[model samples]
Target: MTDQFLHDLLGRMTTDEKVAQLMQLATPFFKGASNSGEITGPMVNMNVTDETVENTGSVLGAWGAKEIKAIQERHLQENRLGIPLLMMADVIHGYRTIFPVPLAIGSSWDLELAEKSAQIAAKEAAVSGIHVTFAPMVDLVRDPRWGRVMESTGEDPYLNGAFARVQVEGFQGDDLKNNTDTLASCVKHFAAYGAAEGGRDYNTVNMSERDLREYYLPAYKAALEAGSEMVMTAFNTVDGIPATGNKTLMRDLLREEWGFDGVLISDWGAVKELIPHGVAANEKEAAEKAIKAGLDIEMMTTTYASHLKELIEEEKVDASLLDEAVLRVLELKQKLGLFENPYRGADEEREKEVIRCDEHRQTAQDLAAKSAVLLKNDNVLPLKKEQKIALIGPFAEGNDILGPWSFLGSTDDAITVKAGIEQKLNKEVIAAKGSDIETGEDDDLQKAIKLAGEAEVVVLALGEASEMSGEAGSRTNIQLPAPQLKLVEEIVKIGKPTVAVLFNGRPLDLHGVIDKTDAVLEAWFPGTEGGAAIADLLYGEVNPSGKLTMSFPDNVGQVPVYYNHFNTGRPKGAPDAQIRYVSQYLDSPNAPMFPFGYGLSYTTYAYDQFSLSRETLKKGETLTAQVNVSNTGKVAGEEIVQLYIQDKVGEIVRPLKELKGFEKIHLEPGETKTVQFTITEEQLRYHHADLSYTSDPGEFVVFVGPNSAEVEAQSFELE
Candidate 1:
């Protein structure tokens, strides 16, 4: 439908009905009939009876196919105008067949796989009648101590952008109306929720405009470009105002400038919490303020349902704004084909067939293998066939293998590391619990140590628990939790060679363990097939190609650190540099423990001299930036050849380097390949003070490397 048709429909809506369109409740995917209304979380009320399904909004709990259909039917048959309620649930990693968390997927750095994951998720969700998903959270997280980092794609803006695009495409699909399996992708947390102060979840995000525009906005912009249907406002405040009511962010940047035509929904109860943000007089005022700021939908907040119409009648809010907000929502529903067939996706059989099928499981396994980042390999990994190995850690054998937001997923279905190792090994393997995840007890540690001492090889299965790095799981200290590190130290004390297989959701501060362990595998929370994939890499069945998505800081003080830092005039001069003068720390170096894009492989690779097609290029012209990479080691491996560009001189001092493009490739032993990146003037463009995007004519530096830190640079001029 065109704007004219949408306007006519908007003009026909009653004030109460328009308010109803803006209100969304927490309804689960599964459908149910409740004689008595139910209260959930702090704010949701679901009134489901034999006759009518009436409530502020509904929350989808652990409902399966039959239940999902049954509940949606009630909403269609009973609600006023038979306008079906918006269905939602935490479809985090996977609905049926779980995959690794966002952190694990980030390690892969393969946006295609990320996109595929989203597509499958959309397929399953659409089949189940879920109209929207709270995902593609494009928050640029700098602090690893924030637990929700596990749910993000990592700390680099470029990689996050690539991943966000794939996810957006996956959720929304190419065509929303035709793809019944496609649900509207809700790009989340409007602005800067990840830079929570002190790496704590729900803390204030105080960042400069230069930093926010240059770094954080890129991912959200990429998501929008990928066709996201909605955006969920974050819970945290940017500078001073909470995201739910931040006009500059929601209106000036997102709507007016970016021209986003999607519905803006609040993060659960974020609108009412404006009172906590001290921005609103009460919940009613909060509702008025959020809607006025261009927020189109109130998720689980009855404020819009109960207070918006009153605010309009009292002359506290404009009717046009409310109409515009409702129109956006109606436009989305119309685009989703909900207006034509409200029950188009309410098929029970299709939902069952799509959920947890073999195709989804296979994809999960492939992603699990791809997401495993090899941090260190000291010529001891890819263990020999007859080797006696000992696997140790609380996570080594448990079912709590899936990471956070894994709602209704079966832990019992998970394939443990021990099981995988045992199945693959011809010889006997001993496995023991090293220590409790949160606590550092000795009984388990002693047993683990004993097994390590006897075995020729020790595979220490370690890292944070499933809950340690997602949502409310933030921690100030990111070190390997206690006695587990001590257990590693004890096992290291022995003469036997050891490899550490870590399962974590965030970048951990492993200062002491870095050099001690012979090989370190950052396994992340690889889903049900995690064990099989780890074993495959352990025995050289698969080479480790994954790289670190987030920069691993050496210590807690350098919380917000990355590889693309600007050099100050007062540079740190080696270790002898005075700490008072530069960005250097008193106790540590200015570098991260593990830089962004840092990862190791069993096979060696060499970066040859970079060759450019032309050193000087005119406007609208292209430059072919090429580099020859050779696999020098015995076994075949894959490498992510990264290309970065630096603006040598600009009106504003640009970043030292920015990732331009990258390619992931597989090469056999001694195989050489010349990889090329097509660079255009668009690559040099930056957001100006006026928010206009344009490239300045100047000299540029192109750097090609295995990772951000180890790069070879060349210069060019753009006239």
Candidate 2:
């Protein structure tokens, strides 16, 4: 359909019909008349009726070819204009073949793998009739206390922006209109949802516009630039206005400034939430504000359905705004080819053939392997196949490895760590649940200790339960659960060689576990093939290369610790210097337990011979920074050579260092590789005090290394 056709269709739609196009409801609402659909929970008072459901333009949280086809067929039958219902779902990581959570994927630092995971998710979801996935959630998160941090790529704006673009490309492909395997991408939480106050979920976000642009908004802009078909408003308020109804953010910045003409939908219940957010008094006011603010759709609520028509009739909202919103919806449907076929990619047989196929599962396995971060090692990794081993923990044989937001993945199909290791080793292994994820009795600890005493080495499978880390899963104590810690303390006292294999979603304070374990592997929710990937790394079948995207605090008290923090007036003194009035913690070190970009491999790489192509850089000039990286250890490995830059002086204080570029390289023993980074003038620009983005003429420091904490430095001048 062309623009003219969409406009003509919109012209034909009644005020009621147009209002319905802006309303999205769940599957239960469309379960037929005999079903006598009843509202429950939050919907009981929402005033949604069967008639409203009949006219709704979109359906969410519904999938499977048969079910979606039935819904579409039924919706089209009742819809006044026969506008096909847009089907959407949360296909975050994978559909059936689950991959690592977004945080784990970010650790891989491999955009190709990240893009492939999104592509696989699209392929599986498209066959199931999902038109859009609320994914590539590119919120840049620094605090792990926010449960949804698991949904985002880590703290860096640049890295998150890079992943956002590639992931969107993977989901939509080059031609979303023609591709049967692709689903339209909806980059979410439009503005700074991750910076919820005090790292709490769905809380207020108050930051300077400069802070919002400098640190948070880049990823969303990048995704939109990459052609995401839609954007979802966040649940939080920006400044004092809720994002769903923040006109300055939604209209001035997103639509007028950024030129995002795609449909903008409110996050689940966000528009109605404007009442609770103190911005609107009732559903009528909420509906008026959201539409005027440029929100095209209201998800999971009846604010628009209940009051949008009346609001338009009263001229509270311009009729043209409603038409424009409806136009965007119809345009999306036309782009998805739903206008031609109501059941666009809904094929039951195709869904069966594509869901969790061997090829897709293999990709999941490979990504899972690349995502597990080696946090600590003491020659205990690559466990000898012949050694007597004890795999002890709740997750040792548990199938709950799939992290949150993996709505389509089945735990029954997930491979357990016990299962993966059994296939790798012929020797009999002692496996026991050392403790429950959050609870452990004396007997459980005794059994774990007995198993450890009998085995030559102990592999302690530990970490939070899958429920502890997604949405609404914030933690004040970002450490292992108490019972699990007790179990670890007892097992480590047995004095056998121990390897701690952690499965979690967020970065944890691992001071206790790291000290007692000979080796620690952060296998963050590795999905369906997680167990197998862990086994591969344990037996030397694969070398771990994942780096930490989020920094690990030394304690929960250091909640917002990140590597790119600005220097204070009174910086910390030297390690051996007396701590008097300097900015140092009284009881803890100022540094993080595990810095960003920190990871260990089975073998080591050495960095040296750092050089710059020029001592001075002029405006519009690009400087090449080169460093020689060598595999100095005995075994083959992969290294993420990171490049960071620092402005020596600025109008506004700059961070100590900012990650600008990185390269993941694989090398054989004794192999030498020269890693070169071309730094452009654009990379030096930052939001000034007045919020103008520009670079100052001054000296700059360039650092290159394996991680943010340890790096070799050089200096250059920008003219």
Candidate 3:
């Protein structure tokens, strides 16, 4: 439908019908309307009537071709205007053929793979009748204690913004209405949801406006610029106002300033949550505040459904706001082609044919391999197949490799590590569950010891269970579980060659595992084909090239440690320096266990001959930094050459270094490549003390190397 047609449709809708368009409910409400409906679960007290349920404009958490087709057909038949109900779900990583979690995908530093994974998810989800996916969650997260950190890319505004754009392009493609295999992308948690205080889920977020704009808002802005059709409000409060009702944030910044005219939906029950956040008195007040704040949809709540019509009638809320919100909803439906065909892209045969197909699985396998980070190595990797091997740990035979938010992926289809290893070697391979993931009393430690004694080498598969990481999965202690550590200690006492393969979601403190293992691979929740990918890396079929997106702390007490932190007045000196009164920990080093952008490959590379095109840069000039990287080792490998910039002096203190650009290159033995980065004046701009974004004339330092901590530096002046 065109704009005129959508306007006409809105003109024809009644106040009740228009209000219903702004309300979204789950499948339970629809299933509980008649004699056949049981009215089970949480919807019992929602007081949702049959008319309200039938008039709802969207349905979430309901999929499958047959189920969606029936729901849409029924909704359209009952809806007086015949406006179709939009089907949306949380298709985070994959629909069936799961890929690595978002954090792991960030580690790959492969934008193409990240985009391809979203593309596959879109295709699979589209065929299953899902028109929208609440994905590509572009929140920049520095705190791993926020369980949802697994949902976001790591903590860099530039990196997260870059990935956000690609993910949006992959999901919506060029033309959303014409693309049958694509689903509309919704970039979520609109303003600083990831910066929850205490690193707790849904905790209050109190940050300066400068911090919000400098670090939190870029990725969401980038996604909208990439043409995302929807934006979801955050669950936390910005300053003292809940994001669901913060007019300054939702209206002034998002709508007026950013010009985002797309549908703005509240997170699940967030609009109603304003009452609990102490901003609203009741459902009517919550409904009024949300609509006035420019929220178009109240997801999974009856606040709008219960009180919006009365609020409009009493003139507590303007009727035009209702029409505008309804217009955005109809506009989205029109763009999704729901106006033409209620069951858009819902095909049972296509769903069966495309779900977890070989091509999709191959892409998952490829991404899984690229997402594995090599944290430590001592010539113990690339295990020889002829040597007797022992694969011991809870994860060796377990198939729970798919991380959280993989709602549709079945564990039955997941490939176990034992299965992947057996396909490679014909020799004796002893596999044992050394201990349970969190319990040491499985009585399998003795058997694991015997297997290790018989084998020439041991591959210890360890890490947190899949349940330990995603949403509501925060951990106060970010180290390996005591039982798993005990298993590692006993196995390492045997003194055989050991390789530790970790499957986790968040960055972990790996001091214990690193001390005992000869090689450590952080295979963070690699999806469906994760086991196969791990086996491939171990056997040299694939080289480890993934980098750390989030920094690993030395201990849990060093929470919120990131590489791009601002320098304090008293900075810590080198470990050898016995300096007092410095900002150093009494018992621990000031540095992270593993720095950001840190990873190891099977072979080594050397960086040399760093040069700059100019010693001074003008306001509008671009400077080029060049570095020569050579494969100095005996084997072929890939390297992520990183470029970082630092402002020598600023009105406000700046981070020690900020990642500006990076290039991943592959080289053969003895091959040398020249990596060049073009830095412009725009890259130097930052939010000043008064919140004005500008750059200062001063000296700047440029660093280029493999990771943030180890780099070669040069100086230049900005005029």
User: In order, how many clashes per candidate?
Assistant: 14, 0, 0
Candidates sorted on lDDT, descending: 2, 3, 1
Question: Cα miss at 265, model 1 (Å)?
Answer: 0.3
lDDT per residue, candidate 2, 13-63, as tens digits? 778888888899877788632233655788677677767777788887888
- Candidate 2 local lDDT, residue 328: 90
lDDT of 1 by residue, 1-719 (tens): 57687788777767877877776654441235342144545634423232222532334342454555666676666565655556666677776677899888988988888888888877776777777788878788888889999888887788888888888888888788877888788887789898888888888988877678888889999999988888889888886889999998898889998999798988877898899889999888898789878998776666877688899999999899988887787788778787677655767877777887888877987898889988888889889878888888877786577898776567888878988888788445678888878787777778888888889988888888888879899888788877778888888998788888888888988876777899899988998778878888899999889988888888888877887777676777746666587767788777898888888888989999698889897888999999999999999999999999999878777888888899999999999999999999988988777656788887999999998889999888999
Summing lDDT over every window of 10 consecutive residues in candidate 1, give the lowest-scoring window: 47-56
**CA lDDT, every model vs. true structure:** 0.81, 0.90, 0.90
- Which 10 consecutive residues of model 3 have the lowest summed lDDT? 31-40
Please say which candidate is ahead in lDDT: 1 or 2: 2
Quote model 3's TM-score: 0.98
**In order, what is each prediction's RMSD in angstroms?**
2.7, 1.5, 1.7
